[model samples]
Target: MPLSARRLVLIAAACILVGILAGRFLFEGLILAAAGIAVLAVALSYGPGSRWFSPVTWVVCVAGTLWTAATAGYWMSVSAAADAAQEVPAVASTLFYIGVGGLVIMAGGVVTAAVLRTLGVRRISSAGG
Candidate 1:
């Protein structure tokens, strides 16, 4: 796999970890740890001749993105609903920021992948230099 492909995969996996952590309401340390594992998995999968073209991989990537976005939406909605009860703005603000970040990441990944695929990849000759 190319570096770009690897990075893409890692990003997708990271989204998955974020989704899982958010849904589980895990502590910060565990969430970070899970995200790290996802990043490592993605990076390690990036090697020449690696079978990264499976349909299941694509399914997982798409599902992960959707899951992340949905999870973010859930958190944001809950926070908004509780705004009347809590005087502290920090909690709601932080949750909103995280949700926005997740949405941005998901959108960026989809757009980037689509653009790259539509443009297509070309090979450069290594024998010249």
Candidate 2:
């Protein structure tokens, strides 16, 4: 299931669409949607990369994807209601803040995990040796 360039572009378009549905601001949805895609990519690669990641990491990726998707759906509904009422809900800002905060923490964890994993890998042997 190698992704082609065209497929990647289409995926990016879809992410933007999902992002539009997920946030009060485009950046927020972009963040969450991008993160969701990242997690999905990791989960999909579990077979060949199994040794590099623990089972827990895989579980987290799957769970995170589910949570992010569900929240995006909620965000869509909120937009619908707000549109119908012709006024933004007072709580919408709070929702954005919580979403951004959680994404920041999750992003930090991802960076830290990647750093640790890279450090744990053994150095390659020189061809001359």
Q: Each model's C-alpha lDDT?
A: 0.48, 0.53
Determine the C-alpha RMSD for candidate 2 after optimal superposition of all C-alphas: 6.6
What's the TM-score of each model vs. the native?
0.35, 0.46
Angstrom error at residue 46, model 1:
7.3
lDDT of candidate 1 over 68-126, digit per residue (tens): 44444555556566766755445556655654555455444445544443443322234
Query: Over the stretch 77-122, how does candidate 2's per-residue lDDT look in tens digits?
Result: 5767777986656565566665565455445445555555455443
Q: Score residue 72 of candidate 1 by CA lDDT.
A: 47
Residue 37 of model 1, lDDT score:
41
**Which residue runs of candidate 1 sit more than 4 Å off their true CA positions?**
9-51, 86-129
Total backbone collisions for each predicted model: 1, 0
* lDDT value, residue 116 of candidate 1: 45
lDDT of 2: 0.53
